[model samples]
Target: MQQSITPQHEHEHHESMKVFGFWIFLMTDCILFACLFATFAVLRTHTDSPFTGNELFEIPGFTAETFILLTSSFTSGLATLAMNKGKVKPLIGWLAVTVLLGAAFIGLEINEFMKMVSEGATISTNAFLSSFYTLVSTHGLHVSVGIVWMIAIMIQLKKHGIQSVTKRKVQVMSLYWHFLDVVWIFLFTVVYLMGVM
Candidate 1:
């Protein structure tokens, strides 16, 4: 004989299932980033020609990029909190801030890359430079895509208000934004700090 679940129990089960699925997704993303980092690590020391991290990395530029992304993560978190409170205006405002910060981060990244290329650190200069560009630029590309996604979600939130679907979307965005921040932390440590050392 099968036992029936109470309404409360059913809701709890659903929530648990959703959280479990989200955690699995996050783990998969972590694995993906791990592989990327490993590839970058292996390629970072391949200085067959000119254009090494010491020659290419600008501390001030990367510092600004890091701050922008970190602040965006904060704003995205605040947006999620505001949404939980059912406050639409603050949620939208925070999400807008997140989007702006994300855009600024990408802009700084692109500017840094352009500056490096102007200084002759083209990707073909060496395997190290190639991997450096690929790794960092790939992260920047992800930030750009996240900004676009945030804008679309913001529009939908504005039009529909914070319904269950919108709330779920915002929660997912929060997870993604935080995940990006985590990736950046690793990148900063591995690429920037390790390179300088």
Candidate 2:
């Protein structure tokens, strides 16, 4: 007799493997971020520079950016819920909202960086500035990549509707969005809050 696999069993196996793979990838990314954060933390308060976080970081601007990102995360969650119910219109709308929110966050961050640079706080100014730019900009780059990924998925959804494969992709992207949000929370606490203090 030949062995047979049921559809339900196959789906469960695939999902389990996907979750495991995602977790592993997340852990590796965490390690990379940890190194960057550690470097920044060590150099953040270096007194060799005329410019410092107190002079460079505008708390109101960072607060707005944080709000935009957090709101985007919530919209991404709503998008995922809409996708699960096979409601394409609401899903697309929510995703569009998320994209807009993400774009807004990026815009604010860029403006803040420009202001700092104009005030003589370029990344090359000192070790503190360099590490600060690297750590925070790395996170910004990730958010930009996530936005591009979201747009690609939106296109895929339009072409394929809500098939199993598309559903799985959305599920994974949702996890990615949430992961980014969690990372931002830590970045805000560690980099922004600590720098101000």
Candidate 3:
């Protein structure tokens, strides 16, 4: 005779399915970003405008932004650790720091875009600028959305304490934050380091 699953066992199975589905979603996102990066690589050489990535990009500012994002990723990991410990206070604190760092990174990106525009290097100016702006801005938009998501998770944690549901939500957010940081590392290598070289 077939045995029926207990409620607790069934619930655990559901949770495992949810986590697997999320991983699938992340894989799709990885594909999307890969296409974008490929497009950027193809178009980066198409422009013969007076302004180039090497000339327009500010190394010190970009470096600072990179540092901030890496640090934020670290803080996000801390938040996850706090969540695992069931300490709502430290989790919120670490999440807040992550939010601030994410916002700072977005602000720096916008400033860089504005400076380029002021210098007459707009998206319409050439193919290179178009692809460059598209790639970077898409990443920035993701970061902005992630920041909002983080705040919503914080609010949930505040209202519900460290329930299993809240813990899962925070874990997902932490995964997203880490994914963004990984993408930025590749972007920094392809767009900035190569540009400078």
Candidate 4:
């Protein structure tokens, strides 16, 4: 005879499935970034404009952006840790810090993009600019989505407290935040460091 499924088991099963589904989404995102990277690589050398990565890329600004995003990832982890301990205030506090850092990173990126555009290095300026804008902007969009998602989760946590559902959401958001940090590391190395060199 088949055993009856308990409520605890049902909850656990759903939680595990949510985590598994998030992993699949991340894998697809990895593939998407890979394709974007390949496109950027291929088209980066095909510039018709005077503005190139070597000329336009600012090392210090992107470096600071990297620092802010990486710190946000760390704070995201702290938020997860706080959730695991069932501390609502600290969890929310950590998430607030993470959101602030995320916003700062996005602000800096937009500033950089505006600077480039002012220098006539727009997407229409060349294939390189087109691909560069596409790839970097896509990553920025992801971070923006994550920030919004984190805020929504914060509201849920405040209303519901640290239930299994909120816990899973924190876990998923933490994972997504870390993934963005990893992607930015690559973007920094490939698009900025190598470009400047």
Candidate 5:
């Protein structure tokens, strides 16, 4: 006789599929960011701007942003850990912390952009600045999306507590958070650290 699927089994299948689909999505995002990074590399020097990345980028500010983002990644992991343990409060608390850190990171990025603009490094100034803005701001946009997503998840967690669905959602968000942080590491090294060198 053929085995009939139970509701729990069906949900389990759906949960696995959700994670698998998200991985596929992340892979496509990887391709998109790779193209952006390549474009940035090619245009890093084709500039008419008065200042280069070395002169324009402040180490302390970007360093702080990196630290905050990396810390938030850790906090996100903690949230996931809490969820796996069936604890709702800690998961929500960690998500809240992650949101604050993400907001701070975005704030620093905007400040950096504004400072550059004030100093004559506008997007239209040159190919280099244009590429820089495009690559970095693309990452910023992703982080902003992540912040919004996390907030929405937090609301769901509040209403539903730690159900199977909520757990999977948290897992997906945590993965996305880490993915953004990994991309930022490359961006910091490629765009800022290398620039200052």
Candidate 6:
């Protein structure tokens, strides 16, 4: 005789699908960024561009932004570990630190954009500047969304503690946070380093 499937097994299967779906979404996200990167590559060397990369890019500021983001990623991992250990208080603390670091990153990025605009490096100035702003701003938008999602998860953690649902959410958030860090690493190398060079 064939055995019937259990409810617990069904639930596990469903959660696994949710994770698989998230990974699929991330793949599409990768495609979107890839297109933006390609656009930047083509426009990066347009002959009539007003500003050279080295003139507009600030090395020290970018370095600080990189450090902050990397730290935030580490804190996010700690949050996940806290959840796995069923420690709600430390999980909340770690999530708060990650959010604050993310906010700081956004603040610094906005300041940089504003300063560049004030110096006549506006997106409408040329193709190169347009591409640069679009790529960076798109990434900034993603980080902003992650921050909002994190706030919601923090609220849930407070209300529900580390239930199975909350645990899965925390895991997904950690995956997204780590993914952003990886993307920033590439952006730092391609955009900032290459610009300075």
Which number leads on lDDT?
5
The per-residue C-alpha lDDT of model 5 at residue 153 equals: 97
Considering TM-score, where higher is better, how would the candidates rank from best to worst? 5, 4, 6, 3, 2, 1
Choose 1 or 5, whichever is better by lDDT.
Answer: 5
Worst ten in a row by lDDT for model 5 = 1-10
lDDT for 106 in candidate 6 is 100
What residue pairs clash in candidate 5, if any at all?
A: none
Query: Which digits, one per residue and each the tens of the lDDT, describe model 1 over residues 79-197?
Result: 99999999999999999999989988887877888888898888888878877777787777777878888999999998999976678778877888898898998888899878866
Model 2 is weakest, by summed lDDT over 10 consecutive residues, at 1-10
lDDT score for residue 167 of model 4? 92
lDDT tens digits, residue span 1-197, model 5: 13565777888899989999999999999999999999999989886545799889999999999999999999999999999999999999999999999999999999999999999898888899989999999999999999999999999999999998988999999999999999999999999999999
Error of 6 at 159 (Å): 0.6
TM-score of every candidate = 0.88, 0.93, 0.95, 0.96, 0.96, 0.95
lDDT of model number 5:
0.94
By summed lDDT, the worst window of 10 consecutive residues in model 6 runs over: 1-10
Which regions of candidate 1 deviate over 4 angstroms? 1-19, 48-50
Report model 3's TM-score to 2 decimal places: 0.95
Query: 19 in model 6: Cα distance from truth in Å?
Result: 0.9
Report the C-alpha lDDT of model 4 over 68-101, residue by residue, as the tens digit.
9989999999999988888999999999999999
The deviation in Å at residue 193 for candidate 6 is 0.4
Backbone collision count in every prediction? 0, 0, 0, 0, 0, 0
Q: In model 4, what lDDT does residue 91 have?
A: 100
Writing each residue's lDDT as its tens digit, candidate 3 over 102-147 gives 9999999999999999989998998888889888999999999999
| TM-score of candidate 2 versus the correct structure, residues matched by position | 0.93
Model 6 TM: 0.95
Ranking by lDDT: 5, 4, 6, 3, 2, 1
lDDT of 2 by residue, 48-157 (tens): 64587766678899989889999999999999999888899899889899989999999999998998899888888888989989999999998999899999999999
Candidate 4 TM-score to native: 0.96
Greater-lDDT candidate between 3 and 6: 6
CA-lDDT, candidates in order = 0.83, 0.87, 0.91, 0.93, 0.94, 0.91
